[model samples]
Target: MQPLLSSYSSSSSLTIFLVSLLLVGDHGGARIILPANVTVPAVIAFGDSIMDQGANNNLNTLAKANFAPYGKDSVAGIPTGRFSNNRTPADMLVEQMGIKEFMPAYLDPSLDDKELLTGVSFASAGSGFDPQTPNLLGVLSFADQLDQFKEYIEKLKGIVGEERTQYILTNSLFLVVAGSNDLANTYFTIGIRKLQYDIPSYSNLMVSSASNFIKDIYKLGARRIVVFNAPPVGCLPLQRTLSGNEHRMCAEKHNKAAQLYNNKLQAELKHLHNTLAESKIVNIDIYKPLLAIMKNPKQYGLEVVDRGCCGTGNIEVAILCNRLLPTCLDASKYLFWDSFHPTEKGYNILMNEVVGRHASDWF
Candidate 1:
């Protein structure tokens, strides 16, 4: 399979491809099901709330989304700390790969030894690559997450022995989705970082932190790692509402910072690829596609792009987006479910872009 849609460019072509892949069945008159021929043995996730399945629920943090309307359209129809109204990119990616239904939160006490073999997410809500970002928000730091990953490896070794564990570690797909919080929450916010460093310097610090995290994971036996660059932070509903003034325009300054960080991150990943033998450190640009979606909402069947589906969508997120506030009846019409996060429908579009971009790498 030399990538299913290597030549397709238009959205109509993409839609046709999707139906053929997801809906069409075999000629035997039964639903055509295939075995999961996943390239990796497992998919480990480490990042911020964008990839946080339900890790924050176990932590003593103010950033939590394990409540009603959050999981309004999830597989179980129950909130599991995902910021979206339904399944996230993490959920969609693994399923499309035919690996598993959903990646469970690593901190979930109910996770058994067997489940550890597939994979679990270590991402926490409000976390950032910056050490102080998580600390400031009272969430798990990236450093802490890495330590947890180390411990997870040890536990896996105990369960399946060292040989199998090594194989799993080397073959697993490590997903790193962070840095948005560092720029959007910590640096841009009226905090110590703003007083200490300029946008360029702060972005450099983020790149350094992210680069170190990648190197550490590589040393820990990760081989296939996909690091998602930060999305357009300025376009986020919260940022727009905060700085958009009365007209509610996007904060271009924040978007520029996001681009700066992404450029640096891509350069760092390329350097890692050249230096770290057997390590596949890939950089995925999410901002471009996401920006297109926001710019042309009609192209993606969306109506509300300036606000979120959860309450006002201006500033509410995590705990602030509570059950007391009524949610949008049609989440599909909105790009964001909350102030900063995309709705499940929005995430679905993102997943399509990811798969289209990285299908060759996965296959």
Candidate 2:
């Protein structure tokens, strides 16, 4: 096989093209032989819609997007409840690591023992660290996701036996991406937490919740864990729409809140890494990259930064972004695919940056 690096002009382009290939199949695309060395045995994802592969499809949640126009650029050309046109960050990271091109949803009925051996995503759409977040959408909470993970381990035990399951759990890469919904959707939109706690107090709650989650998973034999910081939710199309003014911009207050929470979360992660035995808890700063894209769309080959590709691009998402609604002709030009989610192209760019800048140090 030809070297993928030589074939592509840049890493970002390589990542984007490779993700498309992964989604559809090689389809006569470059087939670069991945290095024999595997970084992590598997990548187990836990979070909200950002990482959800299709877990919400099986649930009676209103946050589902398993229909047409959602996966317009995907290989299957059908919605897979991924919250993107194609694969997500989870899929990109897993594929980039040579674990698998596609990580199946743990809740999918067709999930087999073979797929479980490599990896599977346990994330659910509309989930968050705060219980109220999921409660609002009738989706899984952080605790509920943890419970599902526990159930997954039991199932793994049955498939690969106790010892192998333990080995996989200890060696695999555990990705936790929460809090975005907690702040953006739950606290801000619903105002339930605002009535009880102030911004600082609420951010502290998010940090505490994240710490508990990391510690719990560490106790469960997870050694390599990557937790994502909340992005600039204020920059999301929905939030911008809520700004009301015709000349709306990224909400500064919300962005500031995200930065504060991220600072606290990073400090907590560093402390956890120092304390946890044999654990490598790493923090992935999602805010900076995402914010950069929003600031300079041309820098990332994106034309539209303020709105999404689906329908009105301001507030429509999930159920509202149906097949009947007109979507952008080329999703690649748009930074966001929906009101709250990044486009598949945007995810590819993020994945490339993340793997290039961060993964080398950890792996």
Candidate 3:
């Protein structure tokens, strides 16, 4: 993976700050400290559009930015393939924690330029734990994204020295939002294994792909991993709308497959934490939170439960998500900002539920 990557640190924006945070105590090896005068070393990110900043914008693929109505409502008010009008949950998390405002995408061509430094966002839109899905979507795969991180590490080592760079990355928080693409694209898109394998076969593939992805990030010195699971795809407006059956909801068969994969992921990840020579992995159950929110939208203050902000949730997403082609009157009111993605408000609610102190088996 290291050799397969392009030279990192070529970006002038990449630099190391001489900073450190002390672990006052431990939560059974978990590093949970008082939110006082603490310091954040760095934040490294990976996954899909949920955490993506501008990796797709630099890529010469159909899945790109360089447009409007995309970031229109965003503070930036300019498109950047973020899948949101403003900063994502990852960004919000960073800010709330008093770290940098945003993370950097290792795949961004501007890595060599230190001006672009904050944290790195390697989550390419249309990409996922399943590498092949990106090939179909024409985006970077999870493995490739990790490869970029490895290269970034090496570059940082050269720029700031290995020990210092490792220290920073080793202590940094990692928010990995992935695996959603697999459920939405694979099982539903092409009917996974319907051509060859069955549900078990495909689910196994997903577990392996995602589990290994977490391991690789760990190898790169990430200690805190918030590995998010797939959202309630069945409850998503787009899915319900596309099925065309008002009563039809997300594909239960697909959600079942996703839940199965997540369960396996949790077990395997815990085992990895137990077995790994020197590392820790934390499971961030984005799945359950989203499910709860969907089950009780009223709890989150949402009115229109079935429809997206787009005129018709289902039709609006695939066609006018960012096309300037009449979209929903308000992006905040809808659960789904687009067909397959959530609105800034939805992500905020989603992230709110994810908030709290967690840990691995170590401090």
TM-scores for all predictions = 0.88, 0.89, 0.82
* lDDT score for residue 355 of model 2: 66
Deviating ranges (above 4 Å) for candidate 1: 1-38
Question: How would the candidate models be sorted by TM-score, starting from the highest?
Answer: 2, 1, 3
Evaluate model 3: give its lDDT: 0.61
* Among all candidates shown, the one with the greatest TM-score: 2
Tally clashes: model 2: 0
Against the unseen true structure, what C-alpha lDDT does each candidate score?
A: 0.78, 0.77, 0.61
Give candidate 1's TM-score.
0.88
Residue-by-residue lDDT tens digits, candidate 2, 1-363: 124224435754433222111010011111223345744678899988888899889787667879878888887698888888888888877776667788888888898888888888888888777767777777877888888888889989999899999999988889999887777656776677998998899999999988999888888789889998988888887777664255667887888888999999999999999999888889998889888878888987899988889987866677767888899998989988887788888887766666665774454
The runs of at least 3 residues in candidate 3 whose Cα sits more than 4 Å from the true structure, single-residue gaps closed, are 1-39, 107-118, 357-363
Q: Which ten-residue region of model 3 has the weakest summed lDDT?
A: 18-27
- Which residue pairs collide, candidate 2? none
Residue 167 lDDT in model 3? 79
Clashes of each: 0, 0, 22
